[model samples]
Target: MVSLPEELQAREAAARQRVEELQAEAAELAVRLERARAALSRLEITRETVMEVLADLSAAEVEAHDAPDPRETPAPHGIGVMAVPPWREGLVAGVLPDVYRDIVEIVADAPGPLQAKQIVPRIGLEATTAKIEGTRGKLKRLVERGWLDEDTPGRFTLARHEGDAGHVNSR
Candidate 1:
């Protein structure tokens, strides 16, 4: 039979051991969390670098190509290679790639400004964080190119060009 003092000592030891185990588990989880954060940072950097490279390539391609006849309707740009062009008179959303055209059409059709998260599902993409961020980038690019307006930060709407109220819908 164990004495009361021995039983208390044993219980204390077990509790200490359990605390140590919990500490070890917490340390491991912290390490894993740090690794995941680093990986996410690296992926974001890689994505930005790729987008820059693609934009540069698109610009080079546009410069190298011979100018098309002004009288002829321009062909729709290919997917994954086209840069958002600056909006101009007679420039319609049809000349943009499918994703960009859809974005423009969605904004144009919306009653008011829309957030990137709201646009994500409408663009047929899952409303994940990555997709929302990517869509936000595209929306920012459109605003830069004069295709869209960011009246309030993070909210987007079609750019209102004089005499081109129906241009976005022309696509």
Candidate 2:
């Protein structure tokens, strides 16, 4: 049989090899995680763009028709997914007040959830506490209107189908 000292050294070598393997695996996983995050960010932007286009088209259709079409429904949040809120299904700018429109735009462009104070700089508004509070209120209203989703108590992000107006009826 092998000596005890030799056996301990052999076990140590095996343990070291296992550790190296684990380290390599962890590195690979980290790379994959980063790639996934990038892809998700790109996809979110694409979704927002598509929703905006759809909303503009729907608004044009609504203007041309001069009558609400019963056949069309609000554009879905995703591929064949559930419908978004009615306000987001058309030209939000046409419907919402100017301040609300600015709020939506600011939140939509944010990379992640944004607090009201952070929004003031991006939207070119005053940075007073009252202004921040007002921003918070407006953000909350947008959430109520289905234009945004509150990621946390005081932070918000754009909803997936934010600007999606469902299919427009052909004239």
Candidate 3:
């Protein structure tokens, strides 16, 4: 080692202090770098797990939501229950079959059960097995709902007269 004067000794001490400050700064930077790497890893894992969970939940929803309406039950009568079609014809004379519209028209003009067979031609409902039976099924529902009453075995007309409408209560 070369001999140094008193003035040079002070400069050498300052150089050692500067080296210590740089060492401390490097240590702090190393700690920050490790924390940043750990945070990045945690975010990657969280993103992958979230994607997997969403995929499973989507699959479950598809399985559960696909189903038919339970209210569409089979009609008790030989004919099946059909939807009450939207009424667009003039005068709200109650729910009547499209084919049986004429039958209702005739009855509204002159009230009575124009027999099942007689109603076919007038209402344009040809006396086919499916058509007749479906109409009969519809008649049964209307009767149950108090919109039609079986005056005789096969003869079904309107629910009841306005005066007797109160007596037509479901048992």
Candidate 4:
């Protein structure tokens, strides 16, 4: 026959052991939860970085698609031989590319003839040698296409036709 006090002591020891086991399990579960949270944070960062890179790539593709290739061969009949088309009576500056249109507008609005260095800054470009040279090339192309004139060397102005007035308007 077991005594009542002895039975009570035995039950108390079992309960203490169960409590210790439960506490150990809880500590291990907490570590696992922290590790999972850290992994989720890392994954979120990686996903955001990938999305940014993809967006940049998409923008670059659009720009490349919109920009005309300078080295492309001309089609028959001189239809597509040049990027800067020859100016006609009804032709407007809007027919040109974004950079070309901006250049024409700047030249048209200038009080006097402009040089490549003078035009570069007005077109929101940095005043670097490469930028100046590129602008010079565009200016020469415009001159050749009859959109502009080079009355003096390295100076550009809007071309004047016999009956075409207000050909280039500010937009």
Alpha-carbon local distance difference test for all models: 0.85, 0.69, 0.55, 0.81
lDDT of 1 by residue, 84-149 (tens): 666767778877767888999999999999999999999999999999999999999999989999
Task: Give each prediction's root-mean-square deviation over alpha carbons.
Answer: 6.9, 13.7, 25.9, 16.6
Error of 4 at 124 (Å): 0.9
TM-score for all models, in order of appearance: 0.57, 0.44, 0.35, 0.52
Model 4 segments more than 4 A misplaced? 1-81
**How would you encode candidate 3's per-residue C-alpha lDDT over 112-138 as one tens digit per residue?**
674556555555677887777766776
Model 2 misses residue 134 by how many Å? 0.8
> Which candidate number has the best TM-score?
1
Worst 10 residues of 4 by lDDT: 72-81
Best by lDDT: 1
Runs of candidate 1 exceeding 4 Å displacement: 1-82
Candidate 2 on 36-155: residue-level lDDT in tens?
999999999999988888778667654775645423432334553323234434434334445666777777666789999999877788899998988888888778866778867888
Among all windows of 10 consecutive residues in model 3, the one with the lowest summed lDDT is 69-78
- By lDDT, rank the candidates, best first: 1, 4, 2, 3
Model 3 clash count equals 0
lDDT score for candidate 2 against the true structure:
0.69
| Candidate 3 vs 4: which has more TM-score | 4
Looking at model 4, residue 128 earns an lDDT score of 100
Give me the runs in candidate 3 sitting further than 4 Å from their true place: 1-103, 163-171
